[model samples]
Target: MQETRVAVAGTSFPAVRQHLEEMLPGAVVEAVPVELLRSGGCAAEVLVPAMCRIDAAVIDRVDGLRLIHQWGAGLDGVDIEAASRRGVLVANVPAGVGGNAESVAEWCVMAAIAVNRRLPVLQRVLRSGAAWGDPPGRSLHGRTAGIVGLGGIGQALALRLRPFGMRVLGVRRREDAELAGRLGLAWIGGAAQLPELLRQSDCLFLCLPLTEATRRLIDERALALLPAGACVVNAGRGGVVDQAALVRALESGRLGGAALDVFEQEPLDPASPLADRPDVLATPHIAGVTDSSYRGIARRVIENIHRLHDGRPLLDCVNADPAGAQASRDS
Candidate 1:
């Protein structure tokens, strides 16, 4: 039997390769760094774009590519239309399925608190031996927290924040009163109500994906809607907020601070102005990179691979009909 080839386009290659090999002894998994993959040097039956962007050109370069499986829920980086045109299947492990949502929710909650308390400034003060009470911070209690994108992660965060005595407000693409009631959110509204949400939020959390409609959704005008000294926390795709607008708001003292886990650009430029600011708390996009999430994600990936081998329909396929694709391949 010929060995099945799998190419991984992000970090944790060794661990993923080992796991897949152990489970499917006849499969050959190799790491194809994003740089190499972009330069048209990938040849595999399955492509796992863990943290890499798979565009139309890169997809065309990979010979015999059948599947483009994302390690987590965010498939914004993949060009689903292009993959479907080439008869390739694209799928992702949904946020809540792999503990990814819970992990990210925890990170968002921590970030919200950190920015609210001005943690970065406190760290600097401690190191500089400045006055102990020079930079007083506010408490989460009795403050309004507006969560955009009421998906798995947003819903998880809402539930977690309620215990902190926060008045949680959620905005989804559509309104879900039942969900709001279940999560104990003070109120829930649709996207059109974003301006209302912003005006009331003491701390705003962005947890939506990046798309045409969402790119820079929180621009200068939107930032102007926020109450002065309000903090911002972003665990979603970086492009959802305008970096320049955020910087201006922070610099002009219009906004309190920001905590960011994801950036518009990966491997954020070291010399970027946002890097060393005391008011900005930055993390390198590891919100959902926990052991619990990875284990569950790996199991799902393996299951899809096995399904592909057996001519069975793949799970969570976003583009292309899985059953039809499998049948076409068999024929």
Candidate 2:
């Protein structure tokens, strides 16, 4: 039998090569830079794309390539339509936040409390050595937290919120069959209920996807529904909330505050109004990305490669194709 040749595409960290070599014994794996994974000269049975682009035509070069293992959850870079048409199995690792949800949830809760109590103003007084009485901070012990797009991250967040003694109201496209039995979580209808959920929720945490229907889902009209003191945390796609409208609401004091991780424009423009807002706590999209999350890319790649070589089920196959996987099945 001929030896199986696999190409490792897109590098994560320097140690990935050593770890992968030890995991797959006897497998002839070539660690090539992401730019060269698709070069015609490569004879890889399996192509693991880390940061490599898998456009519609990427598969043409690797006529004998079997699988395309991805490093991250979002497959926007990978051309699913082209790969699905060409019969290539694309894999991803959602990784379930790997305890990242707790940190993110903690950040969101802190932002909410920070604004609710007007801690920034109090901090100013404290810095100047001025005395101040209790700032009006609401207790999170019994507030309602509305969670949108109840997916892996959403579920992770909801579970963590349980200890806070908060009422968790979920506004999703449909009821999660898995969390259906869980108490404290009440499914509050569809997108129509977003306004009402906003009115009722003390804090709204959005963990949604970016789809055509979901674009601007939290625009101006939705912002008007929230009570004056309601807070928002968008850990989801930024397109879900309208930035311009959000800034206006924050400026007018119609909305309490916001904690935004992702934004419509990544590496957010310096002059954006939200950046200077005292009520806004904006992070550089670091909610789910950690060293552990980075390793997830490599681990998922190894798992997908093993699945393809062993003829087992491919995990996170976003681009599911037959020939793309079977091309090297015989080899």
Best by lDDT: 1
- For candidate 2, lDDT tens digit of each residue in 77-172? 577777767666677666363444555555566666666666666776688787767456667778888888776677777777778888888888
Q: What is the TM-score of each candidate against the true structure?
A: 0.93, 0.73
In angstroms, what RMSD does candidate 1 have relative to the true structure?
2.2
Sliding window of 10 residues with minimal summed lDDT for model 2? 322-331
For residues 1-331, could you state the per-residue lDDT of candidate 1 as single tens digits?
3578998876643566666677667888888877778776677989988567899988987998999998788898899999988888898898878788999999998888888788998999999988898688889999999999988889889989999999999999888899989999988999999999999999999989888999999999999999998999999999999999999999999999999988888878999878989889999888887777777888898888877777788889887464765667744
Model 2 scores a C-alpha lDDT of 0.69
Each model's C-alpha lDDT? 0.87, 0.69
In angstroms, give how far residue 18 of model 2 lies from its true place: 11
